[model samples]
Target chain A: MSEITPEEHTQDTRPAKHSGERYFGWTSHPKAGLYTFIFVGVLAVGLALADFFVHRHEYIHLAEFKIFYALFGFAAFGGVVLSGWPLRKLLGRPENYYEPEEETDNG
Target chain B: MGDTLMSLLSHTNPGFIVILAGMLAYVIRGEIPRAVVTIGGPLLGLAALVLHSALSEPLATLNMMDMTFVLYQVERVSIVFGLAFLIAATVNSIFALHNKDPLQDSMALIYAGAAIAATFAGDLITVFVFWELTAVSSVFLILKSGTPEAYKASMRYLGIQILSGVLLLMGATFIMGEYGTLEFDAFISEGEGLSLQDDPGAIFLFVALGIKAAFPLLHNWLQDSYSKATHTGAVVLSAFTTKLAVYALWRFFPGEDSLIWIGAIMTVFPVFFAVIENDLRKVLAYSLNNQVGFMVCAIGIGTPLALNGAAAHAFAHIIYKGLLFMSMGAVMYRVGTTKATELGGLYRTMPFTAIFCIIGAASISAFPLFSGFVAKSLTMSAVGYEHMTIIWMMLLFASAGVLEHSGIKIPFFAFFAHDSGKRPKEAPFNMLLAMGIASFFCIWIGFPFLGGTEFLYGLLPYRDEAMVYLEQSLWTTDHVLTQMQLLVFAALAFIVLNRVKLYPPEKRGVVLDFDWVYRRPLYHALVWTGAVWSKAGPAMTGAALRLSRRVYNRIEATFSPQGELSRGPLSAGMAIWTSIVLAIVMVLALIVGPH
Candidate 1:
C-alpha cells in the first residue's frame, strides 16, 4: 500500500506528493488577470442589460422593474446558501473514503 | 408440417432469445467469438420488437385471477424506453469489452433484458416479476468491485430495489382485489364515474411510485449506491430503475396535482447538493435527480406537450447522463479514482475523453443545440404555458446550476482544472467508443432534420402538441435570448466566482447531505433495532410462556376431579339441599298464585 493510506477501510489510494497546494493547476495563470476578468464580466452584463432595454423595444419600465431585481436577489441568496453550508462537506478530499491498512503479524 | 411450423413459431419470443443467448454464451465461453455474445442482445431486442405481437408472453401467465399480464405492449412511451434500454445495453457492452468480469457482463445483460421486459409487460404481475429481476441482476456490477464497500453498497441497492418491488406488489394486490383483474390498461375503479382520491388503494399506489421516482427525502439511496459501484456498474445503473418508475408513473398517475410541486422540488434541491458534492459520480447523481425533477414536473403537468417532454427528457437524459458516467468511469479507470479534488490534469493524455466528457456536460447543461436543449426546453415552455412563474424561474435557475457543476466542474476538474501532475494514460478503446456514441446522440437528437426529435415525439404520450411546439417558436429570438441569458449569466457567474476565488476550493471532507441522516442515523437505528430485537426477544417470550403455564396449573389444581373441588363435594351437597328448599317454596308460590 501507498504511504497515505487511511487505516480503517482496506482499499489502496494513489498518494499525493504535495497536497497543501499543488498549485491546483494555476501554474500558468497570472493572478492579476483574474481581476480583469471579474471587472470585464460585470461591465459586459451591465452594458448588455442596458442595450436590451434601450435598443430592443423602446418600452420603458425602469422604475417599476422589481421582478428582475427579485430574480437577481434570489439567485445571490441561493448561491450563498449552496456554497456556505454544503459545499465544504459535499466536495471532499479524494474518492478513497476507505484505504487499506498496513500489514501486521502477531503469529 | 406441424413440427416444422411449431419450430419456426417458437423463435418469436424475445425472452427465449435473451435467456438462450445468455446460456449459450456461458457454454461457449472459450470456443465462440466474443462478438457473437456482444452482438446478441440488440439483435434479439430488434427481432423481439418486430415479432412480439405474433408470439405470446412466454412461460408467463396473463391469466391469474382473471388478470392477464401482457408481457409485451407496443405503446409509444414503452417503445421509447425499451429502445433506449436496448441502445444503452449495446453501448454499455462495448464500454465493458476490455473488461472481463463474467459476473458483471452476464448480470448486465440479464438486468437490461429484465428492464426491457418490464417495459413491455402488459400486467402488474409481469411488471413486478421483471422489476425484481432488475434488482437482483444489477447488484453483480457493484459486487464485482470486490471491495467491502462495494458489497455493502450493493446490498443496500438491492435492498431498496427489492423493497420497492414489494411495495409495488402490495399495491398490485390491493388493485387486483378491488378490480378482480391485474391487466394494466386504464381503469376507473370498476364502476365509478370519477376515480376519486378516496378510492381504496390509490394512495398506496402513489406512494409506491413516489419511492421509485426518488421523491425528495426518499432520494439518497441513489447517491449512496451509485457512488460506491464499479465504474462500469455506475454506468449500467443509470438506464433502468428510475425510468421504470417513470413508466409506472405515466401508467398510474398522469395528472395528479401533488406531483407538480413534488416534481418542482425534485428538480431544485439536488442542485444545491450537486454543487457541493465531492465525488463527480455522486454530483452527477444529484444532477440526475434534478433532471428527473423535470420529467416528474412534466408528469405533473400531464398535458400532452408536457408528457412528451417528460418522455423525451428521460430518453435524452439516459444517453447524456450515461455518457457523463462513462467518461468519469474512464477517468476512474486511468487514475484509480474519480473524486474531483483527486482528479486533474488528465487532459494532457486523455484529450478525446475530455472532449467527450465536455459534450456530455454541455448536453446535460441544456446548452442550445444540445439534446437537452430540444428536450428540456419543451418542459420549461410547458411551465410557461401554465403561467407558473415561480416554478419557471426555479427551473431556469436549475438549468444554470446544471451548467456550473456538470458542464464546468466535471471535465474541468477531472481533465483540465488543475493538473495533479499525475500523467495517466488515455482511456481504453472501448470506453472511448461508448462515450463517442452517446455524444453523437447528444448532437444527432438536437440537430434539425436528424429525425431524432421526430422519432422521440413519435414515442411520447402526447405527441401532436409537443411536435407543434417544437415546430413553432422554438427558435424565436426572445426564447433563444432568454435561455442564452440564463446560461450566459450562469457561465459568467462560474467564471467570475472562479476568478475572484469565491468558488469553493475543492475540499477533501465528507459533505453531510440528506443521505447522512439516513446513512448514519438510520444505520444506527438499524443497529439499535438489531440490539433491541436480540436483547428483548428471549425475555418477552419467556415471560409470556411462564404466565400461560401458571394459569394452566391453577386451572388444573382447582377444577380437576381428583383435586380440591372433588374433596369439597359434601359442602356442595349442603348447598344442593338449600337450593331444593328454595325450589319447593317457589313452586308453592306459583300454585297459590294460580288458585
Candidate 2:
C-alpha cells in the first residue's frame, strides 16, 4: 500500500503571471503603504477641521462639539476592535469545534 | 385592444412565471437553455409586474374554505419590493450561470419567485403559502453543496424558517378568527400599521416576521446557514429571504413602536460579531443583519419618510449586499475558502473582484457618493426628526461600525493585508458581469437625478416624502463633510491600531452567539440523556421481572389446586364431612319451619 505525503502541498497551483496582470500590486509595497496611510490621515484631519466652517444644523446636543464626528468615528471603531480581543477569548472555538470536519461543504 | 391585453397580463402572477422558469430549468440538461430560463424568467416576471401595476387593484382572487385569497396584489408598497426581488433574481441567475447544478439553479429561481409572490400577496393565507415556499426552495441551495456541514446547516436553516412560517400561520389564524377575514386590508388599516392593541394576533405576526428578518437573538440562522451555502447559493440567499420579511413587516407591522429598540439592537450587536468573525461570508452575513436593522428601524418609525427610507434601503441593500456576497463567492469559488485568516493579497491576481468588493463595501458603509448614503439618509433624518436621540446615536455608532467591519475589513484583509502565499485564478467572466451590473446600480442610485431622472428616490413607496428629503439633499456640504470625516477617521483608527499592533489578529474559530444555547449545551444534554437511558433501561427491566416472578411463586404455593387441599386423602375426607353437615342442617331447618 502506498501512503500520501504532506510535502506535496508545497507545489504552487496558481497560474503563471504575465505582464500587465498585477493591477494593484503597488498597494503591497511598504513605502506606498506608508504614503497611503499618511495621505488618509491628513485627509481625515482636514475633513474634521472643515466641520467648523460648515454650519451643520444640530440634531443631537452632542453634535455641537467640535470634531464630534471624527471623535465618535474613532472611538466607535476603536471600541469594536479593542473589545473584540476580549470577545475572542470568551467566544472563540476551534474551526472544527462545531463539527468534526472542516471544509466539508464541497460541491 | 390594449385594455384587453393588459387585463390578460394582469391576471398572470409574476411569481408563477418565475416558478415555471425554474421548472423548465430543472428539466433541461443543456447549459444555454438553463441559463436562458434562469435569466429570462425574472425579466418576464418584471414584465408581469408592469402589467399588474397597470391594474389599479388586486386581481386573480381565489375562493377557498369560504374565504377570499387575493393571489395578486399590486399596490404602491408592494411594487417596490416586487421589483427589487425581480432584479435580484436576474442578477443572481447571471452570477450563478457558471455553475452547472440544476438543483441549485432551479431552487434559486423558485426562492426568488416565492419572495416576489409573498410581497404581492394581499392576504395572510397567500403570504403564508409563499413564505414557506421560499424556505423550502432556498434550503436546496445550501444542500446542493453536498457536504455534511451544508446538510446539517440547511436542516437547521429549514427548521428555523419553517418554524417562522408556522408562527405566521398561527398569527393569521388568530387574525381570521377575530376579524372573520384573512384579507390584509381587513386586519391592517390602510396607511396605518398593524395595531397590536387592536388585535393580539399582530404580536405573533410581528414575532414571525422578526424571526425571518433575523432580528437580534433569532438571527444565528442567517450567519450559520448562509456561510455554509455554496458560493452561488450564498449570493442567491442574500437576495430574498430576509428582505421579504422586511417587506412583510413594512406592510403589516409598521408603526409597531417596539421595533425601534429591536432594530437598534439588531444594528449594533452584529457589528461586534462581524468584527470577531473569521469567515468572510459569515462577516457578510453579519453585515447583512446590520443593514437590515436600518430598514427595520425605519419601518418601526412608520412615518412617510421613514417608510420610504425602509423601502429604498431594502432596494439598495439587495444590490450592494448581493454584490458583497458575490465578490466573496468569487473568492470562495476561486480559492475554495473565504476564511479571513487564510486569504490576503488576492488583489494581486483577482483585481476586478477586489475592486467590486471595495465598491460594495463603500456603498454599504454609506460613503458620500454611494447608494447607502442616499437611502440611509432618509432613515437617520427620520430618527432625528422624531427626536429619538439615543437611537440616532446608536445608528451613528453602527454606521462607524459598518465602516470598520464591512467597508475596510473586507477589502483590506482579503486584498491588501499581509500576503498569504497563495494565488488563485481570477473570477470567471459571468461572475464579473454580475458584479459589474450590481456595481453600476450602486453608483447609479447613489447620485440622485442622474440620466434625466430621479433614480432610486422615484421608486420609493412614498415618492413625495422621499423627494422632500431628496430636495433637502443627501449631498449637503455639511452632510458630505461629516460623513467623510467619520469614515476617514474610522480608517485612520484601523491604520493606527495596526501600526501599534493593537488590532485583534484574525484567527480560525467559531464565536458563540445565541445559537450556542441550542447547538452546544442543549445538544449535549440530549445526548447525555440518551446515554443514561440506554445504560439503565435493561437493569430496571430485569429487576421488575424478578419481582413479578417471586409474587407468582407465592400465589401458586398458597392457592393452587395441587398445593394443599386437593393433594392429600385427608383433604378429600374433610370436604365430604363439610358437605354432609351442610345437607343435615338444611333438612333440620326445613322441618322446623314447617312445624
Tell me what fraction of the real C-alpha contacts between chains A and B each candidate also makes.
Answer: 0.08, 0.73
Per-prediction DockQ? 0.09, 0.49
Alpha-carbon lDDT, every model: 0.72, 0.87
Q: What's each prediction's clash count? A: 13, 0
- Tens digits of lDDT, candidate 1, B1-595: 9765444433333533454554555445553355467556666665566544432233334455545657565566776777787788779878887776666777777777787778777677887888888889888878888877677677777887888888888877888888786766545311111132676566666776677778998887788788878899899988777887887787677767677888899887887777767789988888888888898888788777777788889899989999999999998888888888898877767778888998999899887778998889888878777777777767766776787778778887888777688877778998999899999999988777888777776666566776677777565555555555556556666666666677777766555666656555676687689779799989999999999999989988877776566576775896699899999999999989866
User: Among these predicted structures, which one has the highest DockQ?
Assistant: 2
Using TM-score, give the best candidate's number.
Answer: 2
Error (Å) of candidate 1 at residue B566 is: 4.9
User: How many pairs of residues in model 1 come into backbone collision?
Assistant: 13
* Candidate 1 segments whose C-alpha is farther than 4 A from its true place: A1-107, B1-28, B31-34, B50-61, B64-66, B186-196, B525-548, B566-595
Report how far off residue A63 is in candidate 1 (Å).
16
